[model samples]
Target: MRQQSSPHLSRGFSSYGCALALAALVALAACSKKEAAAPAPRPVVASIVHPDGQALQAGSLPGEVQARYSTPLSFRVGGKIIERRVRLGDTVKNGEIVALLDPADAQKNAASAQAQLDAAQHNLVYAQQQLERDKAQAKENLIAPAQLEQTTNAYASALAQRDQAQQQAALAKNQLQYTTLVAGHAGVITAEQADTGQNVSAGQAVYNLAWSGDVDVLCDVPESALAAFAVGQNASVTLAALPGRKFSARVRELSPAADQQSRTWRARLTLAQPGPDVRLGMTADVTPAVPLATAAAQHGLFTLPATALFHEGRQPAVWVVRAADNTLELRRVTVTRYDERTIVVSEGLKDGESVVLQGVHTVSAGEKVRAIAPLHPEDFAS
Candidate 1:
């Protein structure tokens, strides 16, 4: 026999079942509604347009300090170096002897030349006296004409010998003088290649003398920047040896052709009143003056963060926000210059226009965006 349930209990069970079904239907509808809703506006960082007017960019390059005029001193005659009077970095005056060679051989040669000249002179004198007697006898017809003619020829030969001997003696004297190497100009000794007891050949470098008056900073520039640098342009130089000091230099020379090895044009800058601190061969840093981009930028030009630049079919473009609806529009821009952190725009949008500086690639054309204040550039300074 089966037991039957009460009427109230059955009614309660049916009501519970209906409530659970209704709850399930409500939750499903709520989930479907949430999934159908539109997404929030895309957030982007942007900056207001500000021209680079009057702002100059500086380009720096490594350089070396050197004398405008340098001389390599060498001996005119080869000999063993007996004495070296000057050392490296020694100050020398004009006509000062810097080195001496072994003068034994030179002195002997000079003496030998002198003896030959004396003998030649005596022979010439004797021949002249004989010629005079011969001429007198010939005039009086006391001797044969052939004999007189022979005496005349002898006198001419002696004269020629005397002249040759004189030239040899002069050369010997010059050789003697050349044994002592002297400085032709007053300057600081930059290098010494020979020492005492060292035998150097003629025309071999013995010392390098650098004039201390004018100084130049030498640097190389690439072909792309050759047009920006001229002979008269001004620049600032900093030396590695002298910290906390800056020197002004004017461009003195710019090579017209590029170097075969470096493919760079050499530039020399003349420093203004360089002090003693500016030593030869010192390393230097040259900061050349950069001209303004264009005269049209006097009014205004746009400069954006490098991240804002995007390529569109080989052309650089930027995402500009439309003022009316805050929608992004891809605008083609002409880039004047580009650096590591910034891009200078010469022609593009108008002044006061806002462009996306960050997250440029994430957004698309005609997409609604929420503009946010861009971070100050200084915040990322490192």
Candidate 2:
């Protein structure tokens, strides 16, 4: 009687255990699905959009101190260069002789012209005396009228020959003076093109002269920055050789066309009162004096880090954070230009708005994010 057991009751207990295990598995799967559906908020490095006017005004371009008038000094007549009075870097005064040519040939031509002129004068005097004699003989009827007329004609021819010889003599004298090259203005010799004993043709360059009076800062400005520079604009110039000093300057000239090789326009800025220490060829930096607020208002530009820019298809876009819910929205922006470390946005942004500075590729539209300042802030300094 003790050994007897109910097999139906044991089977009922086994079925109850299986039902409990299936319910526990279902609950755990639901929890896993919930976690996969909602993700944690991502942290992003970001920066506030700011007006680019200050950045544009802070731009400094490399330049060189130069002369306002730089010209090549050359000879007016062809000859051999016998002597060069001034060397490179020598200061010359107005009307000072800079070089000399061999005067042997010029002197000979001048002397020959003078001798011809003297002979013509003697002939002229003889013709005048003969004309007086012919007039007296014609009045007394002691000589034929035709002979007197011929003598008068001879006098006129002599006078014409004398006038021709006088002009030739004057031209020969000028050529003799041209053998010496004189400086037209007070300036410094910057270059020497023809050396001593070198045979040069007429109007050949001998030395390059930089006029002494006004100094200029010459710079090659890229096409993008050309808009900031205009004629009569004020600027500040600093030289590398003369540190701790800044010279006031004004924009004097700008090239109408861009250079073919560098695609930069040449700008000439005249210094107001350059010191003696400002030498030619010294490296300089030129900063325009345009107001930051004015420049920003005029251009309507904003600046952002290069890492913040993203491309959708062929168009450039940026990620802007929505202030209401800290969500991201992909915005298409119009880029005015691109620098090495930054992008200049002309539209599609506003001041004080936070934009993603990094990790732009990993974020999605409408995703929740926490905006944080960039760890390496120096990257966006430009």
Candidate 3:
């Protein structure tokens, strides 16, 4: 009986040992499968960073060509327009008639004024004759002193009346002349507000004239780009209508206050030598150049698409590619400016360093990645 009990005990112990070993083998297989199923390196678009001077130049701002001196031509007197001599974009000389108004009313007014002046002159002459006769009678003791004084007073009153009538006549004549709308300066008619057979009030604009002198490029600049521009600063202008041509311009005026609606300041750049081809209303591009000695250039500024920026706990960072093992490293960058489509980084990056351009959020530090050029290379163009 003792021997039989020992054999059973030994078999039980062996069975328990086998069960534990089987469990260990299953756990080992599971571990191996998990390792095999691990994710591979992610493919991400990237670009090699270079110190971009054009980024510091602030790119280009859309603008329009305009005249430095634009004035609205209007009639000085109210009347019905009879004819419009100039159309839109017509060049006119100084004092050239651009439009004419119905002069019938003005003619009647002038005639009435002339008639009044003639009557006043006749009255003045009659008063002077009566005063002289009274004076002669008084000297001969045939007229009372009060009567002679009255006659002299009448003569003085008549002279004043004649002078007033003369002024009225002159004013009427000028009003008749004012019926004709003339260009105050040599300019191009940029807009025509009133045409023939239209009634316009006095001082109502009939045409918008852009003086043919200095041409300007007008652009609206946002607050972010305002620092790059200053009055009298030099810039370059390119027109879409006139392709392949670049005009030199200088900052002439910058609005002190920003526009309420657009939050942009109006900037006017005067062309140094604008040709006749640089007509008003032509679409233009204004690019302000950055000097090489600027702080941004000195610090090696780089521009990247806005997608490349990542945030780590509110701190701006980027994913840098490690060349040794094709791994990613999160690097904090000093952002100089945030534009609509790009980010300007001033520090924490070296020239020729590979940086992930897109899908920055999907990457993590120490993760292996495959770096490739962006599909749209134009997006990275300086």
Worst-scoring 10-residue span by lDDT in model 2: 291-300
**Which tens-of-lDDT digit does each residue in 47-87 have in candidate 3?**
88876643444478889998999989999999999999999
Superposed by TM-score, candidate 3 places the C-alpha of residue 187 at a distance from the truth, in angstroms, of 1.1
When sorted by TM-score, best at the front, the candidate numbers are 2, 3, 1
Q: State which candidate has the highest lDDT.
A: 2
Global local distance difference test of model 1: 0.84
The TM-score, computed over Cα atoms with residue i paired to residue i, of candidate 2 is: 0.65
Which model, 2 or 3, shows the larger lDDT? 2
lDDT at residue 129 of model 2 (Cα atoms)? 99
Q: Quote each prediction's TM-score.
A: 0.61, 0.65, 0.64
Highest TM-score, which number? 2
Where does candidate 3 clash, by residue pair? none
Task: Give the Cα error of residue 156 in candidate 2, in Å.
Answer: 15
Q: What total of clashing residue pairs does each candidate reach?
A: 1, 0, 0
Per-residue alpha-carbon lDDT of candidate 2 for residues 1-382, written as tens digits (9 for 90 to 100)? 5786699999999999999999999999999999989888889998787676545545688899999999998887899999999999999999999999999999999999999999999999999999999899899999999999899899999999999999999999999999999999999999999999999999999999999999999998754465567899999999988889989999999999878766578999999999787789999989878743555656677777788899988999999999999999999999976777878788898877899988899999999999988787897675
lDDT of all the models against the reference? 0.84, 0.88, 0.86
